[model samples]
Target chain A: MSELYQQAIKDLAAKGSERLAVPDASSTLDNPLCGDKVTLDVTTADGRIVALGHVTKGCLLCKAAATVAAEQAPGLPVAQAAALADQVRAMLKGGDAPALAGLEPFLAVRPHKSRHDCVLLPFKALAKALASF
Target chain B: MTQSIRSIIPVLARAGFHYLDNAAMAQTPGLVVEAVASHDRTARANIRRGVHEMARRADAAYDAARQSVAAFLSAQADEVVFTGGCTLALNLAAAALAEGLGPGDRVVVSAAEHHSNLLPWLMLAKRKGFAVAVLPVGPDGRLDLADLSMIDGRCKVVAVTHASNVTGAVSDIPRLAEAAHGAGAVLVVDGAQMVPHGPVDPRALGADLYAFAGHKAYGPTGVGVLWGRKEILADLPPVTWGGGMVAALDDDGIEFLEAPHRFEAGTPPVAQAVGLAAALDWMGRLDWAEIRAEEMELTARLLAGLAEIPGVRVVGPTDLAARVPVVSFTVAGCHPHDLSHVLAERGVAVRGGAHCARRLMTALGLDEGCVRASLAPYNDRSDIDALLAGLAEAIQVLG
Candidate 1:
């Protein structure tokens, strides 16, 4: 349990956020398998993300991933923000953790194949939101 | 007795692997496995085709399987139709019944039905211009029959589950049958969950048609049974068509066979049917009264143990009066999938999701669904204890 549910993950997940009042781009995604949902609202400026807000109603992994996305999404280029989701997906498939610092905690989730979607759902919403912008 | 039952299933010999996902698929028994293998090895031929020795053997085995399924439902052999699975059987019923229905005709279904039972009617109703009414589920997860007016004069069909796969709440089929009959509607029951517990007399229960999966009954996959009254089945048109189901093919048109033959299009799952018969034969010899008593005791123990846990809420009826041994629950501040994963790490198997019953989940106010622990005859007290202990740890792990 400690291996997967590390204190860092718990803390990050506890730092939940709400959706933005008015956003440039927003997207909502659902993991139909378990009914986990994540909605992302982004504020973009000068062709880059300046702020990220999220409303995630999912498992601990999903919530923690969404928090990590929210924290690191600021100042990220639109192309790299979408690629970050791909990196996390590849990481879940036994690839190295993305260069992002906060994503390493999700390394423990690498062994759980089914929960991969849970960890990636928020990142997917972020990608979709970026596309919408 | 439990030990002996467990010994017969090869997988139960594995240490520390507690399986509680019997609702999805029961662990196959050695007898059923061997029967399938034996049929494939000895009687491997297309049934109802040539007069060759192998064909005769295969035909005998297939007919015997039909007879066994018929006996289980207390119906005649000619009334049974083998299908790929319970979903296909329900789809066939819907497609065949849709022919007689049109606009202004109402087909009443329950809110507690699995997607397999509900989707077929909804899809067919859209095409046939029939209205589909839902019977509401009570707070306890049982169908609320207080308003039987839903089955009014315009009603043509009443399709529902005999027992809910998630909640394990058994329906009052007799009362439902009475209501359906009073409205001059046919009652089609999804018996996939109930048949696994024990043999059910669909006719006695006031059903015109019944469907159940073979795999859930400890039989081979790719086989299911759909039994309807002889007259009703004769009237129902075939949903599928191919070589074996037809009689003669002229240049102008093709002549189809009778109910069971017309419905069994293409080459059927002969070996799987043989295996289902063997499984049902083994189940027939068992004293269900004793087994059910033990199952109820386990259900009682499971409910009590769940009650002792903090923030754990049972989704279905808390009592064991009219339910099977299936239990579903959710934990506060812990998602069911995460908890199920933690339990899987502890070698406890369970299912977590809407369980293909989205309507029921919405009715129960479960946004993330719940974890279910379904029991079979081979499951004993140790399995229940393992699940309870694993859940305690899962709460801590995901909390």
Candidate 2:
């Protein structure tokens, strides 16, 4: 197994907290090409994310990305979470990696262009959910 | 046999690429590529129009292509009509046949049909108010012909695939033709998959109209053949109108050319047609028995290897006699897209998706689709070995 699959599997096995209570904002994103789906729920307090939960039915890469997002979302400002989404997109597109410690694992996926969408699926849903807040 | 055939494709040796996606688009032989390039360089001009020298040469080449295609299908020269591609050919047939029908007319298509065969009829049914009935496929991935009650005298056409792209199962065309003929309905066959794997004589297959794409048969893209009986061709009206198809036209009325000529609109794909002829010629020189024998061996290896994997489940028939070498499977706990990506990383190319037969995917309960490895004459046991190795690596990585 390559370092990429190993790192991605580490995030895929993460167990996060429960769904945000009556979630303040939620969004569902689907990749029509492969039928991968990700639904993200966000709860914000004082313009900061209080909690986040994700339900993903897709590839391991997608689920892993969602797990990473859920782990890093709590206590972060909504704007920062949205910015992290942008950073993730840039990282997948072969740009320089962001300084966030949690995002270091995604550096392994840089060389695979076909999997960029898989890594971005959860990010896009989270961005939409954060935007609603 | 495999080494000899592989020598004709330069990329196989140069790039060391294991091409397992022949069911989608075949790798054009070096000779066929040269045929297309040489035609473009030397004899490129508008055919059937100008009276100049180059025009005449172009006309001769185009005519030769038509004759070659007709001969390949065991059809007369006048029975063949060239179209943009297989989809266009099927659409043309559907449009022309639907013109003679009314609201109460019916058209029956199998559930296993590619979208190209199913969509045209559904569009025609919507426009002409004809009812479209679907013939269900059994669990074995073969069409259930047990219930032919839907194909009654009211049925105007019965369109089906000669072989399924997803299942690799060959349909019993002769029996279908007989049933359609008994019900006074014309049989239209989508021969896109069958023609590439073996010889197909449309008349002997009892099809009134047969459509196939050139690229699927190691020919160039943008060219396809639609062969119909002379009488049937005459009865159907031309769907497209343009400069080349008409004999004489005025504000009063228009007189069109006969049969095949009337169907070709605007400028035809002359070079592509030539390439298709060259491909057919190349295929004709090969011994089909040898090709089939090699493919069967490779297929056996693939099925056996996949069967050994605990989580892998093969779709379609498990027996060699029932299908071709097109094998589709789903791996537990692994998405097909991810698996395909891993295989591509390993320098093996295969198709992963619904394969343009979403209905078949649904029928097989593969909601997330499956990975497909399709074999061709150029493929040998080593290619299958590479595939199995790649698959094993994918499972280990994605696990």
Candidate 3:
């Protein structure tokens, strides 16, 4: 197994915290190609993510990505989260990985072009959730 | 014979690449490629339209290709219509038959059919206000011919695949034809998968119409064959009308040519047809008994290796006699896409996702789909071994 797959499995096994209470914004995103779905709920205070939770029905890669995003979302400003999502997208699309600690696990997915969507789907959902606010 | 076959495909000589996606598209032989290139270089002209010598040469080559394809399928030249591909051939057949169908008429299709066979009939039924009935398949993915009571008198056409693309299960064409004929319905057989594996005699199989793609049979892409019984071909209306198809263009209406010519409206893929003929000729030269034996051995190895894997579950029949060399399976903790990616990284090529047979995927209860490793005559024991090793590595890593 590649290092990315092992780390992704580890992240997937570690569950995120419970759902956010009365979130200010939420969004649902689905990748129709493989029927992978990710829904994000975020509670923001003073334009910063105070709490975040997500539900995902997808492959291990997607679940792992979502878990990482949800775990790191708290205390980050909404703008930074949105920017991080864009950076993740670029990184998955063969670009050099940015200096983000949580996103280091996804560096192994750079060689798999077809699977970039799995790693980016959760980020997209989070971006959408932030944009709604 | 296997060495000769291997010599024709250069990619097979590569050190590490193991190709197992033959059911989706077979690797073209060197001779087929050379034939098409030669035709393009020497006899490049539109067929059946000009008085120039090049045109005549092109026309003769195209006609000869039609004859070769006819002989390949055990049909007359006039009974074979050159199509864009198998999907178009099936759509044309469905549309031509829809002209005679009415509100009460029904079309019966098997559950194991690819979307190419099922969707066209469903679309035509929606447009013509006819009913579309699905013939159920067994748990093994083989169509159940015993309970074909659904093909009643109201059924106008019975379209089915000669073999299931996913399960590699060969349907009993003769029995299905008998049932359709007893119900007074014409039978259309989708031979896309079957034609590539062996000889197909539509008449002996009792099919009124047969469709197959050239690329899937080690030929060129963009060319397909739709062979219909003479009487049936004559009665079915032309679905395409244009340049070469018209006999006369009057102010009131247009007169079309004979059955096959009338169906091929625009300029056809002449070089592709010739390449297909070359592929057929090459296949004809091989020893079938040897090829079948080798394929059986490779298939047995694949089935046994996959069965031994902890997380892998084969989807089709367990017995070797019940299927061709195509094998589909799912891993316990791995998604098909992820598994396919891992396999590809290890220099193995296979297919993932519903394989254009979403209904069959649903029937098999594979919500996330499965990985398919299909074999061709060029594939051998080494390819199977690579597949097994890659699969084991994938399971150890993912499971």
Best by TM-score: 1
Report RMSD (Å) for each prediction in the order shown.
1.4, 2.9, 2.9
Residue B368 Cα positional deviation in candidate 1, in Å, after optimal superposition: 1.0
Pairs with backbone N, CA or C atoms under 3 Å apart (clashes), candidate 1: none
Q: lDDT by residue for model 2 over B1-399, one digit each (tens)?
A: 889999998778856478999988989899999999999988899999789988888999999999999888888989999999899999999999999877989999998899999999988888889999988998867899999999899988999999889878888899999989999999999999888887679999999999999999999999999999999999989999986899888898999999899999889999999999999988878899989998888998999999999899888877897577788899998889878878887878998877878788878887777899999999987789888999999998887
Across all candidates, what is each one's fraction of true contacts kept? 0.74, 0.47, 0.29
Local distance difference test values of all predictions, in order: 0.92, 0.87, 0.86
Question: What ranges in model 3 sit over 4 Å off?
Answer: A1-57, A72-90, A95-101, A123-133
Q: Which consecutive 10 residues in model 2 chain B have the weakest lDDT in total?
A: B9-18
Summed over model 3, clashes come to 0
* Comparing 1 and 3 on DockQ, the stronger one: 1
lDDT of 3 by residue, A39-91 (tens): 88898888898887888866778888888788787788889987777889888
**Ten-residue region with minimum lDDT total, candidate 3 chain A:** A8-17
Candidate 2 root-mean-square deviation in Å? 2.9
Instruction: List TM-scores for all candidates, in order.
Output: 0.97, 0.90, 0.91
lDDT of 1 by residue, A1-133 (tens): 6567788887888997989999999999998888999989999888888899999998888999999999998998888887888989999999888777698889999888888999999999999988755
DockQ of each: 0.72, 0.48, 0.42
| Chain A TM per prediction | 0.95, 0.88, 0.88
In CAPRI terms, model 1 is classed as medium
Compose the digit string of candidate 3's lDDT tens values, residues B1-399.
666788779778888988999999999998999999999998889998789988988999999999999888878999999998999999999999999997999999988899999999888888999999998877878787778888889998999999888998988889888889999999999999888887789989999999999999999999999999999999999988777998888899888998899999999999999999999888877777788889889898999999898878898786777567889898987888778878887889998777878788778887777898998898888899999999989777666
